[model samples]
Target: MNSTTVSPVAEVGMLSARERSDHTAFVDGGFLYVWGGHHSVAGEEVFFPSDEIWVYDMSSGVWTIYAMGGEIPPTLSQTCGCCVNGVLYIFGGCAENGHTNQLYCVDLLDGMFTWRNVTDSTGTPPSPRDKHSCWVYADRLIYFGGYGCKQMREVTDSRRFITDEMSWVTIGTMLFRFWGWNNEVHVFDPRTNTWSEPQMHGIPPKPRAAHSSATLGRMGYVCGGVEAPSMNIHCLDLETWTWTEIVPTSTVPVERSWHTLTPLSDSTLFLFGGLSMSGETLSDGWIFDVHRKEWRELQHSHRDKPRLWHSACLGQDSDVIVFGGSRDYALLADTISVLQSPSQSHCSDLLLFDTQPLPLLRLCEDCIGRNARTLEQQLSWLPKKIQEKLRKRILFFRTAKSQGTYNSR
Candidate 1:
């Protein structure tokens, strides 16, 4: 297929960055507010408590502690979350004491909380699950398979809740059980409040967990999650329900999990730090071009300390807000960074060259027939070396940028 090339634009501006420390939290409010789990002061592993909610704002880069008084649900982990309007919905997480099948919603605009017992409803909710995947479409929240008691058994059933009716209902089941991996893509229709069965073209990759997925326009991209052997990246076209594997052409980023993926306006996806397999945290960033299926490793001079299980979201203007994770195996509460694309003046000129022989040049038979000899004349001034270099660069960059930093050679 013919592909279009995009020149790297100069970095012209920066967005605000913030540092709020907590562990294994999620970001909401369009990247403005980050809510995270609490940790003990002794720097030891402690179960998160549901009584307090840590909140961080990107504009001021400040962390605010909120007391969730009343009958708060128990603290939990591997919980799936989604934001609809200004409210945050959390579902199906393993609590400190045991697994939980409850559903809770936190209002960002009003600062109120509501918990519902899913068992009391008529529609059958998916089995008690943890580490599941969920997303919001229109007014409905769609949930997919998660680990049951066996842990990573792949729950195939699906369920959703319509905000207008304040009710829960079961959607169709996914064709494949996704319990083993968290990177599976689940799309929902808000108008009907139902999930379309997982659809994609070609043989799908194996299931994985701790990967990152996000929507860009009508397409969804999944990147950098671990399976048995290594991390892999994939994309799904929502319109056609098709899947394509992305092979990077540059030095890819390190393999990681629990990272954040945010969509930018320029048809690119931005990825931030996460935990490497060796349990070390990372602070590097990368970008993937969705249209061209390419990847680009970013150079950050003012990068923050490495972290894992943190939350990130796009903020006002071009800003990105990140919050909460662990460092050195200890839960953290003090390091936060607001990252923005560097100013265009800071970007150095990049001379891209291709380094491959051109394919046998071909023209439309009718066009060649109209001016058969002229085609050769048009190609005379094009240097084969330069042409080859440009082709190689384009192919290399596209492959490297799409797969992220880990798989690049």
Candidate 2:
């Protein structure tokens, strides 16, 4: 996976720049759906209306906002979300009032684009929390460690992780003593609308929040967020409900949080910019080979663009799509001024990273797409499946042209 990076993040001409951070994005049918989170501008933290969603057509390279219909949750930042099939499900986050345990779902392709509050499902829900990561496998949502309130009734399982576990607690005394972190795992099944916590056996990692995660087959990988400068990775086996730590055989990434992890294949994942353990924002990129258990760095352009708390997802073309995050932490209200370097923290730039170059193939495809209609008479000599494939690409290319967002970025 190590190669001299060529093209940097793909830039869009028609898309206006708007700095955003702590947002969430997912891919569905060649389009990227972004929502939630907040951004700071002009030294002030800005929050978007929770009901509005930004849709980016990867095929067309166009951006559109959809004001969703039906119930919308009030929370903004640090919410756990994931898209399974055509449905998007969200659970818990910090809102204007405070932390909440609200479950919201929406169907992106259904004629009715609406969100439904499903918090009152059949089983018990987790406590109000933020900064957790969710993984979807076998049509179920798997949730793990994050910051949240402690439950009184069932101190039976996660009693070891308490709010006072943090030695650096100096502010928010009440929050430090009452609210804390947990390493609990919860499963939500949409088929029957029930929540279940499987009995786990193996030794689990330390309770953490603000970590990154990715789903590969039956295994879910979690990294960092141990409140220390360490590159620790833990893997969860979905079939057995077990956890095992992974020790990379080679060089590891710098300890970071608030970064992104996108799976390139069943055994490959791309890790990007994050806040370092020293409180500095990072711009290095790494590719992890799961089978070999090794980390390889990507020498790419645009390393000058450092971002944290940003959102990234795998695109339809097997490219990595990164969007909306702070370039600096100066505009943050909660972050200490000494921790951040002076720079433009709020960024609205959307970048595409192509790991593998196919310039010749792409050129040919473009030529064919542009003149697909003219060559329709020649399709009689080709197989039906190949003809259908050509037609689909032509339709996609034309859609992008019609949207006026077709650019060679």
lDDT of 2: 0.73
Name the TM-score of candidate 2. Answer: 0.81
After superposition, candidate 1 runs with Cα above 4 Å error: 1-31, 61-63, 69-71, 117-124, 139-202, 228-231, 330-409
In model 2, the Cα lDDT at residue 117 comes to: 93
Each candidate's TM vs. the true structure? 0.59, 0.81
Model 1 residue 400 lDDT score? 30
Write one digit per residue (lDDT tens) for candidate 1, span 255-288: 8766777766648777887767665667777777
lDDT of 2 at 333: 33
* C-alpha lDDT score of every prediction, in listed order: 0.47, 0.73
Query: For model 2, what is the alpha-carbon lDDT of residue 124?
Result: 78
* Candidate 1 global CA lDDT score: 0.47
RMSD in angstroms, all models?
A: 17.7, 7.4
lDDT of 2 by residue, 171-220 (tens): 44554234566788899999989999888869887777778889999999
